[model samples]
Target: MEAPAYQRIAATFRGRIATGVLRPGDQLPTEHDLADQFGVARQTVRAGLGVLVGEGLIVARRPRGYFVREREHMVYRPQEKSRPRPAVPEMDRFSEQIAATGRTPSYSIEVALIEAGADLAERLRLDPSATVVARRRVRYINGEPTNINDSHFPIDLVRDSEIMLPAYLARGTDRVLAELGYAQHRAIDEIFVRMPTPDEVHRLGLGPGTPVAVHFDTGYTESGRPVQCAVNVLPGDRHRIVFERHWS
Candidate 1:
């Protein structure tokens, strides 16, 4: 059986994109033009373009036509979370990483005392309605929103501590937690890929068809006491998760 007109159209544009015939930020031909070129109806052309949109290969900028999506990926290594940060007087680890890459990093941070939600309550071993200190940061790279790092800590563990402050901790919250005697001896990292929530979309300034990888990092003390549960939201197109291993 012959392929449908829409599939052929999509395949043609997809090949063009792959071969660099169409570059990022380059707009597709107008629907009328594409219809004429493909010898198909305008509706068929729209259906074809929609396939690329769903695959995140292109974006529909209405009032304008669709364009190839641009992508730049930052490396994210989960294994490094438990390692000691450099002994520098930097504000945070994320900023340091970006700086090392010759880019600027900034954040919008806010501290909140919120009731523990079900996921956090279980992770932190807290009672329902227990107050938790939520240190939320919408991290930015070169003035563009990049990711969300919202960490939740048990109130008792972080109350009256630097973690309660909405300002950046020069040594980061992890070191502060250690000073408070809740040093994280181990952590469990889980990554989930899904469609972004509306809040996540707005916070990260993500475009349509962009998914996210939600990293849940739960930390425990040497005695197995849960102390911190961090929720890091990473936009899919903006990050690449990496892991390195050495055979024992």
Candidate 2:
């Protein structure tokens, strides 16, 4: 079947942007001009352009035409999960990464003891409704809220420890876990792409077209017992997951 005129128009512009023919902040032709080119009405041109807008590929500036969006991403490497950190360093891994990249990092954290619902219970190998300690943080970079990192541990595992504190841990929580004889031996990474919930949209300050990437990082002890499960919610426009490998 033949596709609609709006879809073809969107594809034409999408190809141009992907190939770098149209760079960021470059303006698209006027709607009248695009209508004349596509042999369609102005409304049809608007519809085609709207598709790109919703995809976060372009922005519409009133009085002016639409332009390609200026996109920037925070590089996230999954390998950092099992990577080691300083013995008694200044900040957590996220803080270190952002500062290393020459950006200021900060966080607002809170700790709560909650019943491990299905989502967390299954990952931590605990019964549903089991008590657990939840450490939640809204991580910010250069003063902008960037992502959400919430770590969960069985209550019995982290009770009366620094992990139950809400202050910044220069030694980091992982080290505290190690002191408790639950050092992480392995980890699993799970990624999910979906639309943002209302609370997430409010907290992340997301725009109308924004989606999110939910990264579930679960860590286990050498004895094969689950020790930690961290839920990291990253905005689609704000992060890029990266991996590097070499052939031996």
Candidate 3:
């Protein structure tokens, strides 16, 4: 059986983009023009464009036609029941893990501050208005924006530590915490799916119709004190998150 016309059109455009014939920010021809060029109907062109939009390969402007957008690839691995925990020595190691799964890992940190917020205070069991260190980062996989993570930790615990220092910002919190004598013994993760916020759509370069995966993780020290609280938003189409379970 032959593939559908729209799928073929989509594949053609995708190949062009992948081969650099259509670079990021390059404007695509009008739908009518594409229809004429491909000897297809306007709807076929629209369908092709929709595929590109869903793949984060193009963006449509109100007056302008579609333009090439950044693309990313991501994978989620289930924790192995036999191993219990993978030997991830540092946060950078996670990026390496993502790369090993055949996706590129890139990230940018936006905000890292010591401030007091209702959520952080409650999570850390601190008095209302007590200060904590907040860090926000956007992680990219294979050059595509995939997740926005906002994390908070008690300031008193990390103020003078290497984790708060700019030089160690890229090292990730897990390693720094371990060095500071508060190694994480366990983590609880809660995940849900929802539509992306308007701000998230723009900042994460998502299509208007794309939904996001929300992941909440709380890390605890062996003594049971909460060490960190993180909220991560992942683009739905680009990530495949998995969780493994075991019965003892």
Q: What C-alpha lDDT values do all the predictions have?
A: 0.89, 0.90, 0.75
How close is each model in CA RMSD to the real structure?
A: 2.0, 2.6, 7.5
User: Residues 35-138, candidate 2, lDDT per residue (tens digit)?
Assistant: 99999999999999999999888888899889998868889888875677666677777888889989999999999999999999899989997999999999
Where does model 2 exceed 4 Å of error?
1-5, 30-42, 61-65, 244-248
Candidate 2 overall Cα lDDT vs. reference? 0.90
Winner by TM-score: 1
- Cα lDDT of model 1 by residue, 74-161, tens digit: 9988787777666776556677789999999998999999999798988898886999999999989999999899999988888789
Task: List TM-scores for all candidates, in order.
Answer: 0.91, 0.86, 0.64
lDDT of 1 at 220: 93
2 or 3, which is superior by TM-score?
Answer: 2
